[model samples]
Target: MNPTDLSLDDLDRAEAEIETGKRGMRFDQIGSFEPNAPSFLIQDVLERDSQAGVIGDSGSGKTFAVLSLAACIATGKPFAGHSVAHSGPVLYAAGEGRAGLVRRFHAWAKANGVDPLNVPLYLADRGAGLIDADQIAELRAAVRKVAQLHGVPVILIVDTWARALSGADENSAADAGQAIAVLDELRREYGGMTTLVIHHLGAADKTRGRGSTALKAALDSEFLVARNQSSTILLTATKTKDGPTPAPMAFELEDVFLKTLEDGRKVSSAWARPVEYVAESRPAGKNQSVALEVLKQLYAAQKQTLDGAGFAGREALVLVSDWRQACEAAGLDRRRFSEVKASLVDSGKVFLEGPHALLDADAVSGAASESGGTIVPPGRRTHSAMSEIGVSDAFGHFGQNPKGGR
Candidate 1:
């Protein structure tokens, strides 16, 4: 066949054929790639161009937590003190609780001191049936319009995978897998927007959602939201394909008055607010605190430096020499502090990559910690790989920091 000889229809047909069949690319056929860190939507919580799920038991505040995240992303604000790498329109498909969802959204936005009416957050009250091709088309159209208006990619959040799959059998692996495929199709059709689906935990096990293992296996990130004994809402990332699992972030509900009925009864709803950071519960030896402070300062500085170069998505690397200087500045012995690097990495506060120690993606950078001046101890560990390491009321400064020219 002559190159540049095919008609448009002929090329389309050829492409359709390839799409309809199983396809594989040989290793050699794949071209070389420059290593770039994955871009995140909610910094450590969710990555861009990815599909994720939030699974929790009933009344676990799964919906509230997810909406809180969506609100942050829509406003380019911080969520639970973690940075939002980028912000844009958020399309929320309210499948199960439309009325309550609205009140919760208002409460969350107001509680966070964000103006809901101004942000690019849209809600689809049509309920699930998103698995249906017609409904998917409608959603894509709506998202496209919103994305165009906002000049940014849309984040589509489908609340409750079970409701979205309305008629499908949740226990049937084939049915669940097919539903996921439909969601993936919607993701691709959007030309690379994020799709986050809310889900429920399995009846017997409290781990992942109720579905075929393939659902969890296919996700780029999986989160588990639950309430601790203290009644604090904890959001933990259980699985992350491209990045390290982030430490748990806690939220405490705050009440927002909705209205007063004619009968003089007060109507109010509560939404989650990030708990203030408390210094690590475990006592840090005098030298250890100094050592950790040194690393924290360096990481924050590196992160700020990278954000200037349009490479903030990549890990911030602090050189060993820099660490030594920080230790000296913090009045700690450089040699004794050398072991602190290993300790930080072991404790999941940092990562050692090549000659540099990269700040863990969710680690509160020194600048943020310094500004907040508090840190909570790591959350208790579970069988799952993730746990809370620190807490901070690092909100408010998001979107206020001046951006450097890239």
Candidate 2:
């Protein structure tokens, strides 16, 4: 048979028919590779054949952010200011059950003028357990069935990674590694498939993923959805294998009125929208408000300009030393002030540049998020081994800098 005369379908059939003794691809078959092997699923952010994570505290809008991305891929709409390079079917497994997810998607469709029945988006309210062979089989079977009906799904999103674990200690590398392996296997079963799992943040520090280091090790991309000063959330690409991580980006979740019940009650859900960078802000917390007041006093006396590409536009910039002195003079302990300062920098509410700090203009007031729900950090020692992990890992950047760029 002439290789040049064979169609891809024919080549696939030939490859399948090959005997067990002939395991690998023939040299001539190299030309048959998928032309878009690693094409972007979300332009400049995510790619095919990869696994990624969107991690945050509770009610931080991580769910809304990811759902919006999935909707964009399903309907070929740009997400958070980035165009979709490739769009297709999506399988979203809701580990927390069908509760708010369905409404959220409907809200997305309604807001985007898309008929829910038209797109190849499938949802399973109950997600599969990573360590459960039976559930894994069932999930894969469902994916295959969806492919038979619609086209192969471009991405599979697991809502909450912890909820999907059964009879496995998430902190154990062996268990976490095994679960991750199963996900990787499932991802590879379909060509050009993306497995993006949603995870949670550590409790005490409110930094890094909640579970084992192994989970982060397997991720090809990682995005952090955090509350900014303007009552909006910042969806940042913390790690990207293909290129340098993009600059700081932000978005807001707007409430969408889904429908009215027969009883005259109105139903509503929130959907994410690409809003211009609102200075990567965050509203002040109880402790932060005091530090903020001190900064303001110093600013009233004198202020400096932090001119740069990523610095929050002309805002209240003050010397870190002066602010600390003011805080100390006001009965704020040095130790306590350090923690407060770290919190601000870590959350992007305060940007540090060469001993100077710039406070986000909108970081003065508001709730934790648009949902008005704050995430209570959980200490997952067995699950989180970040204490032993370095600041920088092979998988991605672990730096705590809240600047817009790397």
Candidate 3:
């Protein structure tokens, strides 16, 4: 057994045998791909090891949405009316701002009448810093220990992949891929415990994550949050491996806090409004024409620069009222103003600037504006009129007439 006496061939044979022995004892078949397993909707298959990527543009409520999901799971409450299959201890690795997270979690728990401290929840005491492989290993060990002590499986929530990954530049595809691979291995090692990694959407494509394609390619499921239709936050399932796609859910943030009951219990709560998303439709005939007038007025009021980023101070109600008044004055149905605004927005005639809807600034102010801002209201234009004059041609004519004469 003397190491110095062993030949090179002998050492190679011995190493190979050791590896074979290790493989024989390993559970390599646990996650082997199966083609015939029944595919269930994400809502249907509730208990399984899964990983999901929740991404969004800044201020799109990605964090809040995921926090809401975590809260729902923690309380065994339905998430956006979707059923919950399991309620267990959860671990939130808040690497961003601890104080903020504390406040948020407290608010969520209080609002839901759940005790923040009593829940099987754990926060990493590790201070703010880059997470390396050592930290990842430490997290794995800590999670296992917590699960064993609490007798409940842990859902590890890493706030942002950029902060959680150690020694890997999140912006670099190669580095991110390697780092994510490590995370995936950790998830596999844990026998499929749920691991949710919050990440940022890229500036170019708000739907795509910031890192390499590999990040999205390797994930089991993915969710994208964005402002859709109205000011409501839209949560869409972009990818799913073993379940049906979850329909896009909308929500609005109301408030945040922690509350102490009349008794001695402390709970976290978050005031949120669930938004209903309806398909946009144009009003009929004269109502559509009035809607056009209202949009024109709003555009004229703003000097014609309208985009989602503008309209910061106005309320949607106020804008709707203004539209109603303009429609009434034009002898159009005031009741259809909201529908008209929604239609214009959907049609791209009116741009959503945050909460306010107004005509597109570039479109109306540039060559399109040459028609003196005149636009045929939806539903009012006859098929013959539409066939005689296209939108661009009509706008061109309007542009030529600064006064917008018929």
Candidate 4:
């Protein structure tokens, strides 16, 4: 292509890209530009007006870890030992599992002694549809309402990226980009915004997020949620574009008592605590550890739901088959399940009766297993908290008050 072949329309397009700062930077504007050090919403975790991803294998406690961060940001509490600003409200666009989130948030509020309803956290009514422009607009309207009542939401969280795709092909780069653009648009609205997207890892690879690499490429920071060989849930800061990558944070899943059913059974929710906070009374071998943790996560998320296939009078139960499948899907050996279950059963940590598995709460409770955690319903809440401690101490305190939560 010679200079003569350059059409006027091509020049106009190039000029527009340059003006929008999406492509070329003119030499004249370079002299006036000033570069500043990166600012953070959550120090070292989320840079201002940037997008981040928390991705992991299914049943790896990805949602638990992400909710922790969102809760911290909303309440001005420390996040995994990182500093947080009251910054603004948190807008949670839950694509699925809204019921579970309510229970989990209730447990979290109880643990930290905060009233979840008073926290400046707003939840989207419908699932986030990032692939479609119309849905994005609806989300924007919801945010505006949140801003009017509480404040501008600096923290925007998409519980799972797959649900927000709305039939778009995640494997297709073009389709994926459309979804990424939704967050980008929201981020642009606020200069110090942070978007956290929860996603799943590829089933085969078990390392990277599932679908197009475009999602990974678009993130300013990225975290990998996984269970180490010890069955400890860990949040690894895989990438931080503006700062030095932080060391991996280890977490232990603990159940918070939500409520009791009429049948004399208790319903609980899972909470991710810093390793030191959880008293490890139950001893499990490598294979047994992962298997137990997976089952605990499954049951914790939906403890209120009575499994129809479960044994009569059993409220919190995970099917042995589902646990085995999840373990094998996560790269753990399928044959190891038999030994793992037997070991857990013998150790009295897990009770395998017939077709289902139940974790012995008493065995796991080194200190306090069942706390008087109040169950808070979903939709609206006003709560807040702040602590000058590590992740454990930060969330351990009680008696925080609610502000103007929605």
Candidate 3 matches the true fold with a TM-score of 0.58
lDDT of 2 by residue, 116-183 (tens): 99977889858867888898888888889988889889999987888777688878888888788888
The lDDT per prediction is 0.67, 0.68, 0.58, 0.67
In Å, residue 41's CA in model 1 sits off its true spot by 1.1
The residue-by-residue lDDT of candidate 4 on 1-406, one tens digit each, is 4689999999999899889888763357666878776777777667768899998887888888888888888888888788984456988989888988888888888888898778877777768888777887888888778778776788889878888897889899988888888788788776577888899988655546899999888888888787754677777655555555554577777888878999999989988876632323555667876776565544543332222223223334355666666566445687666667655544446543334454665523321122212211111111222111111111112222112211
Query: By TM-score, how accurate is candidate 1?
Result: 0.62
Looking at model 4, the pairs that clash are 113-398, 117-381, 117-382, 118-382, 118-383, 119-382, 119-383
Report per-prediction Cα RMSD to one decimal. 14.9, 13.5, 15.1, 19.3
1 against 3, candidate with superior TM-score: 1
Top candidate on TM-score is 2
Query: Which candidate has the top score in lDDT?
Result: 2
Tens-digit lDDT track of model 1 for 44-71: 6788889888888898888878888898
Give lDDT tens digits, candidate 3, residues 44-118: 433357666887877787877877777777667777777766677777777777776677677777767787777
User: 3 or 4, which is superior by lDDT?
Assistant: 4
**Consecutive 10-residue window with the lowest summed lDDT within model 2:** 386-395
Query: Please, what is the TM-score per model?
Result: 0.62, 0.65, 0.58, 0.61
Model 1 alpha-carbon drift over 4 Å, by segment:
1-31, 261-263, 276-406
Candidates ranked by lDDT, best first? 2, 4, 1, 3
Residue 84 of model 1 has an lDDT of 89
Give candidate 3's error at residue 170 in angstroms. 2.3
Clashing pairs in 2: 203-378, 211-383, 228-281, 228-282, 229-281, 229-282, 229-283
